[model samples]
Target: MEESFMPKVSVIIPVFNVESYLAECLDSVIGQSFYDMEIICIDDCSTDNSLNILMAYAHRDSRVIILRNDCNRGLAFTRNVGLERASGDYILFVDSDDYIVKDLVGITINEIDSVDMVCFNYKKKDEIWNSGDEHIFKMKRGIYEAQEFFVDTVNNNSVVHSAWSKLYKREFLMQEDIRFITGILYEDIVFHFLCMMKAHKISCIPEQLYLYRVRNDSIMTKRVESKNITDYFRIACFIGQFYLEHSFDTRLEKAIEQYIQTVYHSFICNYRRYELANHGYILKEAIAEKRFAKIFGIVSGIENYYGRVQKKIEENIGLIKDGNSILVYGAGDIAKEVIETLNYYDVILEGVAVSDKSGNRKSLFGNKVREITEYLYKRDESLVILAVTYKFYPEIKLKLSELGFNHYLEIF
Candidate 1:
């Protein structure tokens, strides 16, 4: 590849402490069926062997470009560096720990010529290239207007916020000055919305190309601490301001309202009671703002529903015997809430049950995390609590029933 020769796609990967999974991610990128692609890996002063692994690949392939940061910059800043150095016609960001299918580049390139951006589907897994569970793009495959695409993404809860699993036109991003918000937790939210709003035409393909690794240590899935919740509320405020500044239509306003409501629900359900009480005033002030006053009712309703659920659980607490240990299924935010709620009732929480064993093995709430199968064998008689989202409740319930575990309950 010559200096003037531009590739079809520039794959930007921000490398940090991902030495354990960098090689597999690079291998998938280098092995893409599409040859006219540049792999840009920005080493963010990683304190691991990630740089060495990237160097080895760069030595082997001329298309691989490795950039280094002088100091330890966060993901958003590192990604901006990649965007500045990118020379391709299209841009695609891939986390260092995640990989994509072989045909990802080829398929994206085929469809991207007709639209400003191309959206695809992804699968979540614990290991690289594990085809265990996949989430396909549910929208029809065709070009859509910018607003239509935005509304569809919000409604479907699909590819609205994630920077990955989508191919972006470099020129479009540059022209609109769309870049990730540096030093923020949910930086992708603003960038994603800006790109979608600026894009005149977008295309959706129902192909599961990217494999998202659900590591408990990842920034998005890590334990819900005070800063995480605060960052979420900050992002919610930013979204509200963005909508008001643009003066979007009522339909889009409603979509954003729903998005805010969902975030509030998750925040109330995940954060500890004391933490919420300490930080609840910030949310109240944000909602009281003139721009955000419309969603106050939605937020209050979410809190009311949470209270109702807590009352229901309190009313049914007598059903469980004193000796019965509680096992929480799912190790995400919802599970943390379930554990906290049960502790409020003086229930004995045994441990957390995760679907994948290869993920973060760290203990939560001082209880060791175990795979569902291992947990069942260890304490089959414990009262199992399905601490997952509402959409996943039925499927998880069916799974538990098939495994001969009748002592299960769902907190929705």
Candidate 2:
């Protein structure tokens, strides 16, 4: 631990009131199989014994560098402080309440030799550590050209944005000036997107190297609030501007459109969840933001397409009337709107169907929800309205075709 010798990796952990988990997190980092690294612990003026725990670690381990804020800065500011002080070759962000596997640093560093970033898997520390639901997108383990990788991953809906699951090259980050957006909840979204855009080479592996603690009180798990709604809109606006500032190749058009469309859909979903009398005003305010204009333009196009689909459904009302049973094949906000629209025409739906029940609503509009396969028997005589986003349309259509359910129409 000489002053002249630089470490290969700088492990940054931003701390708040996580004293109970701080020691365990530090132990995991200090006991890494890769020993040539510095652990930068930035404490954000915790009211608890978190600062004391960090001091104790710094006392025993010279590699543990502690920096304290004068006041309670948020996670983004604390992480920025660590990044400013980090002198290692690479950077790895670890939350204070989370712990990692012994070889996380070693394996990640080994994989990041020629790559600007190395993204691996992680396990959720629930009742038992499990990786079943950790990765929502399926990606192969290999090295890829970063721009093509970003375009394909975003296009195919096979990308992850969690900052903690990746190892980044310090020079690459510094060259691009990539840092978390201050005063935002989902800063990782913007941070990772910019890194993906600027990076030259990237690697992906299947090893579950990190353990993410899933607690009820965590910011991600907390109930949605007004800040969450407004902050997310602000993030969306930032991303929209980023897309416009960079006129990427025409081939990347679909990828960028997909990203914006997904963000807009989530914005609407969360806006709906936030029950308030001023919801329309919030919506208008978001639309009024000058930077958000591009994003809203994309949304407008999508809504216009759906508007045509709604008219077609209205014109083909006889199709639903001819069916022995009627069902909606999605459980998202669009599906709810579709159902409500159909109900306005006095059409009765038998049930709501989903490709999978996990992380989906069990019911919609007083209709029972079940797997799409469960409704296959009635498909011959039933009229199924496919109400999912178009990105998933081809796969769902293929599944329906494989299941021999031909009496269906997609409301893309």
Candidate 1: C-alpha RMSD to true structure equals 6.6
Residue pairs clashing, model 2: none
Per-prediction TM-score: 0.76, 0.74
lDDT of model number 2: 0.80
The number of the candidate with the highest TM-score is: 1
TM-score between model 1 and native: 0.76
Indicate the TM-score of model 2.
0.74
lDDT of each: 0.76, 0.80
Candidate 1 lDDT over 84-132, as tens digits, reads 9998999999999999999998898888887899988887674321224
Off by over 4 Å in 1: 127-131, 273-290, 296-412
C-alpha displacement of 370 in model 1, angstroms?
21
